[model samples]
Target: MCRLFSLTSRDPVSPMLAINALNVMKEGHDGSGVGLCLRGLGGPFGEMKEAPILSGIFTEAGLKRLSQVSADIGLDPKYSMTFTPKTPPPPGTPKRGTYLARAFDIPDAWKGLAPEELAREYTRFRLMLRTTGEEQGDMQVFSFWPDTLMVKEVGDPMEVAAYLGLDNKDLVARQILAQGRQNTNYAINLYACHPFFIQGVCSMTNGENTAFIPIREYLASRGVDGYCGYQSDSEVFAHILHYTVNRLGLDLEYYKHVITPLTNEELDGHPDRENLVRLKQACRKLVIDGPNCVIGCLPDGSMFMCQDRKKLRPGVVGGKPGVFAFSSEICGLNAAIPDRDTSKDFQPMHLDTAIVRPDCQEVTICSQLQALPHLH
Candidate 1:
C-alpha cells in the first residue's frame, strides 16, 4: 500500500510539511517514488492565478522544443521557476534535467472563449506537450492548469522533496496532496506516480484498483482528450471525478455514488432512490471494486476522501479549525497537524465521504444514507 497525505489550510504552507507526514508512515510504503499535487497556490503563483502553470521536467533540447511549441500555439510565457539540482541526486534516484513550473498567458484568440472551451484547449495543449516529450524522450509534463502544480520523482519521499527544492517559499500552497508510492502493481514511471491530475481535478489512492481496465475503457470511449492516459490504475479515479462533475453536470456528491454505488437494498426507500437507481445503471461501467481509499481535491480547493464499499483500506481525516488532513495513517495526521483534537478525528467507513471545503474550517462527513446538499 502507498502512504497518502493531504492537507488544506487557510494559509499557504510548504510541501515539506506533507513530505514529513509521509515520512512518518514510511513503513507502509516502499521508497519507490513520491508524487505531489499542490493547489490554492501562494507566493508568486498566488498573484498569477489566472495564468495556466505547466509543471514537469525538461532536457535542454526539450526546453527549446517547448518554447517553439508555445510560440506555435500562441501561448505567451508569463513567469517561470526552474530548478537545476544544487547537488547530485541520492542513490537510486535517476539524474534528471531541469525541473520547472512555468505560468503562461492564454492566447488572445482564446480569451473570448467560454470557460469550458478554454479548459478543453488547455487539456489539448498539455497532451500535445506530453506526446511530444514522450516521443522525443526529453519532457514529462504532469499538469497544465491554473492555480495548480505537480511534482513527481522516483526516490524516497524526503530525498525526492529535497532534490526538487520543494521547500522553497515560492512553491507554497494552501492545499497539498502527497503520496509515498510502493510500486507493487507497476514499474516506477514518473507518469505512474500518484496524485494524478486532469483539468482541475486531482486524486491519489492507497490500494490496488481491481476495476481499472473497465473504468479506463469507459472513460476513453467518452472521447475526452484528457482521459487517454492510464499509466497508473489510480489515474482513473481523477478522470472519473472529472466526468461525474464536469461532463455529466452532476453534483459533487454524485461522484461517490458513481464510483461506489449502493445496492438496491441499501438505497431502498431513500429520498433519491429513483435517481440513484438510474445513475447506478447508467454508470455501472464506472463502478470501482476496490480495496481502495481515494483522497482528492476539486477545482474549488475542496478536499475529500472515500473508502471502497468494503472498507478494505485505512484512512483518517483530522485537524484544527483552519487546517485539516486526510491521511492513510493516523501517525501521518499527527505529523502534519499535531495540535488538533484527536477525539474529533474521523475514520470514514464504507458509506462515508469526508470533505473539507476551501475555507478549511471543518470536515463534513456525508453518508450515502443521508441526502446531501447539491454541491457543484
Candidate 2:
C-alpha cells in the first residue's frame, strides 16, 4: 500500500500544501521515496511558463553530454536553475543529487502546431534525452513540458521535501501531485515511484495494477513514443489517460469508461451502449484489474480522480471548486483544507469520476452503464 495526494487551485500554491497532507498518512507508506509533479507553475517558474522546462538529475559528465545532445538536437537550453540540497541527507540515505531545471524554446518546425501535437514532440524530445543521458552516466529525466516541474527522490516524504528546498524556495503551482511509495513484491527503485507523467498527462496511484501487462503491450503498440519505462506497474495509468485524451481525442470521462468498462448486462441499458461496446472491444486491453484509485491532471490543467470497479482502495475527493483536494484519506484533506466542510467531502463511488479545474467547481463523470437513482 501507498499514499497519494493531489490538489488544484485557481491561484498558485506551494506543493508543500500537498506534501504536508501526504505526510499525515506516513503510516501507510514505509517512506521509501516521494515523487511530485507540479503544473500551473508560479514563483520562479511563473515567468517562464511558455518554454518547456526540462527536469532531471545529472552527473557532471552527464551534464556535458546533455549540452552536446541539446546542440545535436537543435533545442538549446535557454535558462537553467540548479538546486543543491542544503539539508544533509539522513543516515543510510543516498546523498542528494544535482537536479537541473532548464527551459528550452519549441523547435521552429513545431511553431504553429496544435498543442497536442507539440506536446507529443516535447515528450519525444524528453525521451531522447533520457535514453541518451542514461548511456552517459547516472542521469535521470522526469518531465519536460511547459508550466511543469517534477522532483523525486528516495527518502521520507518530509525529508525529501526539505532536501529539495520545497518550502523555502519561491516555487509554487496551482496543481501538485505527490506520492509516498510502499514497495511491494519488487525492490525499491526511485523511477518506480508514483506521480508518473507522459506528455501533459500526469498520474499517481494508491494501489497496484494487475492488468499492467496487457495495458503495457497496448501502449507499446501505439508506436507514438514515450511509453517504454515500466519501472512501476502504475505508470500505465498515466499512459492510458494520455492515450484516451491525447491520442483517441476523447474526453476525460471516456478514460473512466476505457479503464473500467461495465459488463454487457449493465451496458445493455446505457444510452451510449453501442459506441461503448465498440470502445470496450477496441480498448479491452486497458480495462484495469485491481483495486486502484487514480488522481491525474491533463495538459489543459484539469484534474481528475477515479476508482477501479472493485473500489478496494481508500480515497476521498473534496474541497471548493477552484481548490479541490484528492487523497487516500480525510486526514490528508484535513491537513490541506481543514476549514472546508468535511461532511461535503465524499468518497467517489466505484463508477464515479470526479473532475476539478482552475475554475471553482467540481463535476462528476459517472459511468453511463448504470442508471441514476429514481430515474424510472
* Best-fitting candidate, scored by lDDT: 1
lDDT of 2 by residue, 119-210 (tens): 77887888877877667656789988888888888888888777778785577888899998645546666668778998878998888788
RMSD of each: 1.2, 3.1
What local lDDT score does residue 328 receive in model 1, on the 0 to 100 scale?
A: 91
Model 1: colliding residue pairs: none
lDDT per residue as tens, model 1, 76-182: 99999986688999777899889999999988899999999999999999999999899999999999999998888888989888887888978899999999974
Give lDDT for model 1.
Answer: 0.90
Per-residue lDDT, model 1, residue 241, is: 94
Question: Worst 10-residue stretch by lDDT in candidate 1?
Answer: 367-376
lDDT of 2: 0.82
Q: Rate the local accuracy (lDDT) of all candidates.
A: 0.90, 0.82
Q: Give me candidate 2's TM-score against the actual structure.
A: 0.93
